[model samples]
Target: MRITDLNPHGGIGANSLFVELGPFKVLVDAGMSPKHEGNEAIPRLDLIDREPLDLILLTHCHLDHLGAMPVALRNHPNVPLVMTPASRVIAQRMLHNSHNVMVRQREENGVRDYPLYRRQEIEQMTGRIFPLAPDNPRFFSSLDGDTMTLTYHHAGHIPGAAGFTLEYHHRKIFFTGDVLFDDMQTLPGATFPREQVDTLVLETTRGASGRPPGYSRDKEVGQLVQAIRETLEGGGSVLLPTFALGRMQEVFSIIHRSMGQRQLPRVPVFASGLGVDLCDYFDQIARKTKAVDFRRQILKDLKVQRLPHGYKPGQRLPGPAIYVLSSGMMVEHTPSYIAAVNLLGDARNLVAFVGYCDPDTPGGLLQQAAEGEYFLFEVLDKRAMLAARRMRFDLSGHADRDELLAFALDLEPRAVVLTHGDPEARDWFADQLRTARPKMQILDPTPLEPVEV
Candidate 1:
């Protein structure tokens, strides 16, 4: 058996991995990298153009994991795919939306374009995706009467996220698809059953540095609530720029729950744009998961609208409201741009960041802003404005140090291969793991770099 990476390893984006075991050729996640001039970074995987792939397995619906699905399917339309049921739904939405953006970006960037697949390609991808329900055993019959039993386990990173195990030819390989830390709020933590394994493909997004002992998601949220309350009591609006999914729902639920416990003031808590739709989506998901109160509260608050997409200053915000808007990183098109333009220079308003941001983005600039640096930010490409204090809190969706180490130690696999991380994070994790298990084989290959087992 062999595994190969097919894109650059550093910075975010363009994630593709190919695995081969006897006659089985499994292509894992294929994603777009930020470094790609446009959509060109979506790997061609032409190396396997002539080889027959047995299956394709998706980690989750994140663009970096499934961005190249359409292209892959166009090149090999008959290959079967597998993922969690909820991910299949999100994948279709995310991919179709991304394809639109890809087309526009390509045209704007003046990049050489090819005959890329269309929305129909996304539909075809969905049609072939066989749901691999958690803990259920399914057999993939081999050409020589040998069988591969595939199992999916909840990864606890997002709703419907999974870590999978494949038993083939008496060797077990465990794939951790974007594992999460114990601090996550919305989903349960990842579970790794003890099993003998030859290889463990893990993610090192949060494994480089160790977190302090005794950290709790509840404590973090409590501190954030206190901070928000202080800002609100001081007569300021709290501007939380968050991703449309995951952290957005987690933060909303946390704030709603805090209000229920009387731990928060009844500020006008609102979310703008597609964020409104996501709440409904979460409600539906929570219902399926038997989450009673969360679903009811989210459904009840469906009517509360925040400031709309293009509100300007002197145009008035909807009172002392707490606005949770989309495009978490304040990427140009999101509502955060509107808020930054309208709310800047107002010492009373606070822009609180909750996730990672690219350095080129407005949110990233806000995060890296110095103490005396005056930010001239713009919304709708209109007049720029200056802002006062901006705050950032690490409400990440990835696993922390202890959680990463715990996963590796608990699994006790024969070898470990790190993927979906930058070189620094990957090296840091591999170095840390060596101290605990010196004999374990650690592989961190560049895109298209293959490893044999």
Candidate 2:
């Protein structure tokens, strides 16, 4: 078996993998990097520009994993796309929003290569997508009499996220896309198969950090609610920078339950962007597939409002309200970034982070900031004192490292390959795996480099 990591620049951006087993050639995902723009942001599809791809599998609908699917289809126009039924429904909406965001970027950032694939391109390829059910394997054959079966399982990271296995000639390889094992408020945890496989390809997203002893997700969530209560009671507002796909909805559900139980005061809840629009899609997924527990009515109950205009730093801004905004990293020009400038200078306000924040993004910078340090809002071209209290809750979407290590060992693979993590994170997993089994073959693949297993 041969596999290539297609993400150029590597380490959790533009996540795509190319696997070649006998006569079958498949592409796992084609993602756009949130950290980079235009051509630099996508995987190196140029490597397979002239190659024949039999299938393009989508692991989920998050932009980092599903963003460049249209471009991949445009490149290998004959290839069939595969995903979960929910992802089939969610992917279109996500891709359309991605196209809209790219168009806006073209005008705002002048990255001429924005809008990498057109709307018609997306529409043209819809007929080829197959939404297969979990545990049911689909067979594909090559002219040379080679047959392979593909099977998917619940990954439990987002509404439609999945992990899959490919079996060829009795040998099996399972790929764990972004995964979470513990159930959250709105979604159930993973229900993956426990069978052993020949090769295991894992995602090491949370390897670098270990959950402290006695840490509890419920306690963390309660603390988040407590923080909001204190902030509001103190006549301050709260800003929760979240990923529009999964994290925002999770927070909404938490807030909904809290308000219903009278744990949190019913104040005006503010949110907008792709996350808000996705409420309709989540509602449909919930009612139809029962994969998620979100509904559009939650917004009606919360009275979520679009942020009012004219929020200038150091001026009076929205008061005593809870704000949940997208671009979890607080990327420039996003709602969270703009709101941060207005909220940071005040001691009465609070900014809480409930997910992973990359150290390079503005959100990460803010997390590292001191109480009175001046933070530069590069896009706004202003520096403000970060007096607002900031805290990080342990509500990560990825599973803990120990849980993943135990999971990898349970698979009992002859060889292991790591994907989707920073350099340090992958290193930690490698070290632990080596310590556990001194002679095991663990491959930390270099980007664009093919390794035989």
Best by TM-score: 2
lDDT by residue for model 2 (1-453), tens = 999999998899899999999889999999999889999999999999888988899999988898998889888877889998889878988999889999999998899998999998878767988988777889998877779999999999999999999999989999999999999999999888988999999999988889999887888999999999999999999999999998899999999999999999999899967899888889998988888989999999999998886655445566899999987888788888888888888899999998888888999999998889999998788888989999999898889999999999998888899999999999999999888878778999999999999
Q: Which stretches of candidate 2 lie over 4 Å from their true place?
A: 309-315
Alpha-carbon deviation at 333 in model 1, angstroms: 1.8
How accurate locally, in lDDT, is each candidate? 0.73, 0.91
Query: Tens-digit lDDT track for model 1 on 273-295?
Result: 65566666666666665221245
| Candidate 2 lDDT trough over 10 residues, lowest sum | 309-318
Clashing pairs in 1: 5-447, 5-448, 6-447, 6-448, 7-447, 13-33, 14-32, 14-33, 181-399, 242-328
lDDT value for model 1: 0.73
Counted clashes in each candidate structure? 10, 0
Clashing pairs in 2: none
